[model samples]
Target chain A: MQGDFYQLLKEQGYVLGMSGQAGVGQALTTATTILAFKYRDGVLVAGDRRATAGNMVMYDRTDKVLEIDRHSVMAIAGVPATAYEMVRILEHSFKYYRRTQLQELSFEGKLRALSKLLKENVPAALAGTGAVVPIFAGYDAEQESAKIYFYDILGAEFEGVEYAVSGSGSPTIRGILHYVNTWGEQPLSAMSEEQAAVQALRLLTSAAEFDSATGGVNREAGLYPVVKLITPNGVTAMADPHLRSLFESNVSKGS
Target chain B: MYEEPYRWVEAVGNRRQYLDAQFAQGSPVVGVSCDQGILLMTMSKGTPKLYEIYDRLALGGMGHPADLEKLRFTLLEMAHVEGFNRSASDVTGSRLIKYGIAPVVKQAFEEVFKAPFIAKLLLGELGQKAGKDGFLTINYDGVFEEKNRYAVLAASSSVEQRMVEYLRPQSCVSLKDAVDLAIHAWAIGDRAQRHTDDTGGDPKDGKGSSDQPVADSQTLMTHIRQCMQGKSIECVLLDRHVAGTSKYRTLGSGELETLLPKDLSSALT
Candidate 1:
C-alpha cells in the first residue's frame, strides 16, 4: 500500500526517500551518521545528533536518522530532501522485495543506488549543493554476514575502510573514524561503549579542534560530541550528558 | 546445480540412510553428512505464523542463522497440520529436498503431534563442552538451544565446527520431534567422524567428535539418548564425557532398552 503511495510519488518526479518521518528527534531526518566497526561477529552504525541547513545547525536533538527497518538504517545529510527520499526508496524496496531479497544489500548495491539518485539530481546537487550522502549497514543474508556503506556528494559510494562516515563534517568525521578504527579496530563490538565513546570523542574533538564544522557535544567545555551506535540489536543514540565525562577526560588530559 | 552431481546427492543420501539405519537398529547413534546444508520443511507458506517467524528472523539474524525462527514457525504450522513452504520447493528444488523428512508427510506427522512446531539446530550446540580454555562449560536440560534465526552454525568441520540442521514436523502430536531431532544428531555425529578423519582433528582427544551437533548437546549423554531413541543400546559411546558423566549421575549401566519395550529394544540393542 505504502509502495503504491511511494510509486505515486516517484511518478510525480519527487524523489522517493526524501519524505522525512518527523518525530521527537529528527525533524526531516536529513542527517549525519557513523556506524561501529564490523567485528568478527557483527557490525555497528553510529551518527551524530545534528542536522544542518548549510551552515546553520537546524536541529541538535534530532537523531540525524533512525532505523527505517530494524537491523539497518539510512542515515543521510546534505539536503534533507536527499536524506528523506533515499530512506523512502529503500524502505519501500525492502517491503516489496523482502521475501525474495536477502537481508543486506551488497556494498556495491548500496553505493550504486546512491550514485544513481545523486547523478539524477545533477541540477540541484551541482548548483548550490543539495547533494545527498548516506551510510547503509546491515547483515547480508546471502553473505551470511554484516557490512557498512558510505556515499559521497556525486552519489559515489564507498565501503569505508572500517567505519562509514557521511555528512557535512565527514572529512573531519572521517578523521575521527580513522583514529577509532586504528585503535578500536574495524569491528567495534569487541570493545566497550566507553572505548568507543573515547574514540568518538577524541575524533569529534579532534575534528572540532581543527575542522570548525565538526564539534563534540561539549561545544563550550570546548568539545561538543554526540554519537549513536548501530549494533545487532539496533540503533543507540548516545546523549551529550554521557558524552561530557568522556569529553572532559580528553580536555583534562590536554590541560 | 539442478542435477546436483551424484557425489553430492549420494553424500546427502548417505546421511539419510544412516538415520534410517539408526531407526532400523533401534539405535540412537546417527551421522548426517551434507555439502551445503539441508532445508527441513516446517510449515506451509503464507501463514501468519510463518510470517511472524520470518519477520523476527529478519530483525534478529545478525550473528546467527535467522532461518530457525521460520523453522520453528514451520514446525508450529506442521504441528497444527498446516501446509508449508511451497516457495521453497518451487524454487530451491533438490537442494531443499536433501533434508531427512519429506514435505508431503510433514503435515501428517504434525497433525499427529498437534502442537505444530519447527526447529533449526545450530552445529555449535551439538558437541562436547569445556576443554583447554574452560569457555565451553554449560548446564541446561536440552543439550542445545532452539536459538532464534541469528544463530545458525556455518562451519564445515567435524573437528571444532559442528553442523546446523532443520526439521519438518509431519504432525502437531509432537510425534516426530524426537525422531527427527535424533536423526539430525545422527547425521551430525557421523559427519563429524568422517570430517575428523578427513581433517585430522584427532577427535578422540580433541572435542571427542569432529562432527559434533552444532547445538553442543553433551552428545555423549543427551544425543546418545537422542541417537538411539527407539533402540536397545546402552549409552552411545558418542562422547566419552557424556558416558563418564552418566556414570557420575549413577544412571543405570546405559541399558537403554530397559527404558523401553524389549521387543522394540532388540531392534537396535
Candidate 2:
C-alpha cells in the first residue's frame, strides 16, 4: 500500500510486460487520431472514435479522450489495452497523492509520473505490442492556465505549445493544423471554443479522408469524435447533440 | 511480559483505557443523509476533522490528528488501489472498513507492544439514490457498524448512543435542515461529554447517566455559542447533484453561513 498506485500494482506481481504473451500483438486493437490545441478559453482536446485491429474496424464508439481528473484529460493514440491501463494508473496516482499528501500533485510531478509509467512499459513498447503515444492536456491551477504535453513510446515528454497530434492519421491532420495555424486568418490560440471545435472536426474529417484508421464521423449512427475542453473551471466533454450541430453547420455543410 | 496470553489481553485492556482517556476532550462528529446528499459536520479547535476520502465517500473522525492522518492515508491508499484495480463503484464504505481499515487498526490494538491508533472514524458513502445512502463507524479497536441515514462518533459509547437517539427520527429535506440537525445533535454529544468531564465520570463504565437532564434548546444554544468562541466548524457534503464522478466537496464558510442559523453563522465569524 503506497501513494503510487502503479508501484502497488507492480509489487502485487501485475506486470505490464507483453513479450511472453505470444500472438497477442498480431492484431492489437489500436486507437487513432488524437489532437489537442490552445483556444481562447483553454485547451481543446479531440479524438476520433475508432479502434482498428490490423485492417479491420474493431469498434466505432471507443472513447479515446479520457478525463483523468477534474482538470486533466488524456487522449490516447495507440494500443487501447495498454493505454487504458496507463490511464487507470495515472488517475489513481493523482488522486492518491492528493489524498495522502493533503495537496494536489505538482504539474511537474504529474508529468514525471506519467513519464515513469511509460518508461516502465518500455519493454512492452519495444516489443511492438503495447505502444501508447498520448496527448495530455490539463489546466494547471498554480499557473492559472491550460497546458498541453505529448509523450512518446520511450517516455520522452515535450510541451506542445500550440498543438500536438498523434496516431496513424496524425500526419494528415498535423499538416493541416500547421498550415492553418501559420497562414490562416488566425492562429489556433485566438480561436473561440466553437471555432476550435469546428477546426478539430474539419481536421479529423480530412484525416479520415486520407487515413483508413480514423473514423471521422458517422452521421446516420450519430457517432462523432470525443471533444473535451480544459479550462480554468475544469474539463467538460462536448455532448453529442452539440457536436452534431457544430459538425452539420460548420463541417458537413462544407462551409 | 506480553509473551503470556493473559498479559497480552491485560495490556490490550490497558491500551483501551488509555485511549478512552485520551479522547476525553475530543469533539464529536455528526453525519446525516438528506435529499441533497450526505452531510458531515464537526466543531474543531484548529485542525480539520472532516475529509473527502474518495469520489463518493467522505470521512469524519474524533481522535489525535496524527493517528487520524495515518488511518486516513491507509484508507486512501486502499480506496484508490481498489478503485483503480476494480472500479469506483466497488469501493464502498463497508468494504473499506471491513477489508481495509478494520484489520490494520485491530492488529495495532492487539499487538500490545505496538502503539495503537487512537482514532474513531466515521465514513459516509453516497449511494445512487436517496434511500440507499450508507454510513459506517469504526472504533479504535476496529469494531465497526454499518448504519443507514445517519451516524455519529463521540468520545464514548454512551455519548454516541445519546447522539444517535437524538438524531434517529429526524429527517432532513434540504442541506440547511441537515446542517441544522447535525449541529444540534453535535451539541447534544458535546454537552454530555462536557458534563462527564466536569464530574470526572469514567467513560468506559457508561457513567454519563441517562437521567442527567437533556439540555434545553436555549442551554444547548448557549453551550454551542461559548464553544464557538475559539473553535471553527468543519462541514462537508457528498452531493449527489454534482456533475462529475467525485461527489465529495467541502462547504466553505461563505456557504456554511447560508446554511447555518443567523446567530450560529454570526458566531462563527
Q: Tell me the spans in candidate 1 whose CA falls farther than 4 Å from its real position.
A: A1-41, A99-112, A173-191, A219-226, A232-255, B1-269
Q: Could you give candidate 2's per-residue lDDT for residues B105-221 as a string of tens digits?
A: 999889887889999999999999998999999999999999998999988999888888888887788999999889898999988887888888887755854546777777777
Error of 2 at B120 (Å): 1.1
- In model 2 chain A, which range of ten residues has the least summed lDDT? A16-25
Model 2 ranges off by over 4 Å:
A20-25, B1-12
- Among all windows of 10 consecutive residues in model 2 chain B, the one with the lowest summed lDDT is B204-213
Q: How well does candidate 1 score on lDDT at residue A78?
A: 61
DockQ of each: 0.01, 0.66
TM-score of 1: 0.41
Give lDDT per model, in order. Answer: 0.40, 0.89
Quote the true-contact fraction of every model: 0.00, 0.75
Residue-wise C-alpha lDDT for candidate 2, range A1-255, written one tens digit per residue: 446767777777777647544455488888589999999999999999999999999999999999988999999988899899888888888887776666788888888888988898888887778889999889998999899999999899999999999999999989899999999999999999999999999999998999999997999999999999999989999999999999999898664
In order of listing, the candidates' clash counts read 87, 0
DockQ score for model 1: 0.01
Tens digit of per-residue lDDT, candidate 1, span A1-255: 321323334554655232222233322324354444554445545555556544566665544454655556666656665556566555534433333232344434544555676666655555543557667666555555566777666666667545666655667667555665567444454566666666665554555455444434645643344455555555455666676766667554664
